[model samples]
Target: MVALRNLLTALFLPVKLCLFVFHHRVGRVRAARAAGDRGAISIELALAVIVLVGIAVAVLAVVMRLANTVKGKVPTDPVVTAAP
Candidate 1:
């Protein structure tokens, strides 16, 4: 049983080593690819657009509120009455 176990271990060692090396190399390759500067501009542009949109929304909200307040304060009648 011990010899059989040894034989099995010897047979599997090379396969395990190959798998480990392949996985490590593939992981390194993926990491390098991900760390590269590809698509950086697109990401930056998306972020900028998001920020600008947020600012625009805030400005529009403020303007709308101000407009509503001003509209409420304006009078419909323009005729001035003279005091007797």
Candidate 2:
């Protein structure tokens, strides 16, 4: 169970870090908007899109890994039906 916990922690660490950075950037964007910084909003939005895409790719990779693991554990067999 220690290994599982470690694995889970490792897997989620990057996601958590990404979320924290994204949150910080959003806050910065909001502060800039409040200060009447027009171009900063566009730059912030572009940065946000890039971060979101990274997060999405990371999530997709994790999901695909999980799917492959599950598929490997499933049994493959042909069903045989008997008629009375």
Candidate 3:
């Protein structure tokens, strides 16, 4: 049994070494692809944020104009006078 075990170990050592090297190389490739994806996502996020901010500013400007118009049309005088 010990001899059989030794023989099997010797036979499989090369296959194990090949697998280890393949996994290490694949891991490096995956890490490089992930780095590129991160940069692209960051740029897209920045552009989206800028567009949202522009929309918010435009909405605020329109609201301010409408508020001013309403304020100008409203009368300051009371509608009903209080009894003395």
Candidate 4:
């Protein structure tokens, strides 16, 4: 039981740290946002998501263009072979 607990703790150490950090940062942002504007975090998050999605779309477009270009350069016609 002790070994299992230790193993679980070790495995989750990074996750715990990440959650802690995320919580701390969000708390600070919430406090800051509370002073003047409400829903500021939501607006910021929405904008960030939009920007990230746009970036993802651009990257996907470039990848698809390259893939199509490469595919066009490859020979795809079946070869005729004389059977012996």
- List model 3 lDDT by residue over 1-84, tens digit each: 999999999989967866785576557557757777656555655675687679769979999999998898788645887889
Q: Write the per-residue lDDT of candidate 4 for residues 1-84, one digit (tens) a residue.
A: 999999999989967966785686578678868786657766766676687679769979999999999898678756879999
> What are the Cα lDDT values of the candidates?
0.74, 0.85, 0.74, 0.78
The residue ranges of model 4 lying beyond 4 angstroms of the native Cα positions read 1-37, 76-84
Candidate 2, residues 1-84: lDDT per residue as tens digits? 999999999989978987897798778878888998979687768977887899889989999999998888676655669988
Model 1, span 34-67: residue lDDT tens: 8884465456546756876797699799999999
Candidate 2 C-alpha RMSD relative to the actual structure = 7.2
The segments of candidate 3 whose C-alpha lies over 4 angstroms from its true place after superposition are 1-36, 76-84
User: For model 4, what is the error of residue 72's alpha carbon versus the real structure, in angstroms, after optimal superposition?
Assistant: 0.1
Best by lDDT: 2
lDDT of 4: 0.78
What lDDT does candidate 4 reach at residue 44? 69
Clashing pairs in 4: none
Residue pair clashes in candidate 2 = none
Candidate 4 lDDT for residue 27: 84
Query: Estimated TM-score per prediction?
Result: 0.45, 0.51, 0.47, 0.49
List residue ranges in candidate 1 displaced over 4 A. 1-36, 76-84
